[model samples]
Target: MNYPKFRKSAELFGVICGGLLISMPAIPQAVAQESTPKINPCPRIFYEEPHNNQVVVPQGCPPNALTQRLAAQGLLPVPATPSQEQTNLGVGGETPQPSVKLPRPASGDQTQQPSPGAVSSDQPPLLQPRQTPSATIALANGTVNIKLVNDTATNVTFQVIGDTAPRSLAGKSDVTLQGLKAPVTVTFEREDGGQLIVTPQASSEPGNLNVTFNEATNAAQGRSAMRVEPNGSVFLN
Candidate 1:
């Protein structure tokens, strides 16, 4: 516990350290080397899209400490989607094909097909072209005779292309429309009240078209619609 005892202890400690230094195994220079970052992960896999620009995280690997530290520095996901309207038109991609207007509910504006062997316009789906019924007819011939007979007891007014004027037939009355052309479409609308079954027999040569009105159709109720095809085939909806 005295100064001499401490001095002796220090001398003995220095001697023991010197001996250990001479006998101990040498530490190679490898301890000073640093390891590269595991950014690529082991087995190195990557995904180009959807996963963004970052490499895939290897399974069983420790959490990415550097990535967690700089998570905000990665690319923002907001810019990936297109924003400009023109780009959305798919400028570099195939232009989106236009979708035809399928028959909507209660859209009565439907045209009928022309006569047999008649070149009809582009028709609706499952039908020929939209008939060019919206035309003005010339009464060059003496008269196109169309016998209009109303089976139901309801007055109905009828009109179509190539018609000089709209004609009205009384309820349950049979009338012949004279001085008309062939391939004339007759559209009927109920005048008095209730449903009217107006049938037109083209009692003359050539073919005539009859357009069916699809108005006030209620799906909940048992109401139906009529579709005229390019072949003049009528379909009840």
Candidate 2:
């Protein structure tokens, strides 16, 4: 064969072998599959107290041999056992006391203890019954003063005075009834009063302040109003 022909044949053979090697499937890389770490469910043994004969076990011990032994000897609370969910969550397992032993009084002692159900009359009466506040409305300088009958430590809150009223007032003292062109209704709340004080604002304009007092919601037993006279005397009644 000619030299050029021989060289071409050799190159063709090499290409075929290379293609076969490239097409072959590859071997998988080796990897170590890790197992999940195991958690020890048992309680630590180091908590055993030899002096008190107490044992602290892992949280979820059943009411079996160990618990029964501790209870029988009065080392643990009687009838106290861990719930199933608590056991699953891992809580509870400590023996605190062996038992409570009550000592008897001396034989010749002439003292008597009151029965458990007895109450002593000498004890001071409970703090005076809380008094309910009476409600009254006082108006000054575009501000309204809701005087409660009783002194309350709590802050007073108020709502606009109608069944369709919105929440508009809340303060420690003296709520400002704003946006008043004519008259508006107001409801007062006392910290101790069961009733609400419902009164209509005396309108500067005729038919402007037409409001009804809801006795059910009125903390004040009576209907009251605040008005400013030309003499500058403010009548709050």
> How far does residue 37 in candidate 2 sit from its true spot (Å)?
99
Residue-level error in angstroms, candidate 1, position 172: 2.4
Error of 1 at 18 (Å): 94
How well is each residue in 1-237 modelled by candidate 1, as lDDT tens digits?
Answer: 499999999999999999898766443333334343223232212222333244433343322333333444662222223334424343223345788988665546555548898765686546667544221222334234445555545566766555546677666666665645443445566675444332323223443323223223333422222223334333332
lDDT of each: 0.44, 0.44
Predicted structure 2, TM vs. truth: 0.19
Q: Candidate 1 has what TM-score? A: 0.27
Off by over 4 Å in 1: 1-144, 200-237
Report the C-alpha lDDT of model 2 over 63-182, residue by residue, as the tens digit.
Answer: 445556677899766544555544544422333345788777787774776778987777786798643322223334444332222123343444545433543233223333444421
In angstroms, give how far residue 102 of model 2 lies from its true place: 99
RMSD vs true structure, all candidates: 22.9, 25.1
TM-score of each: 0.27, 0.19
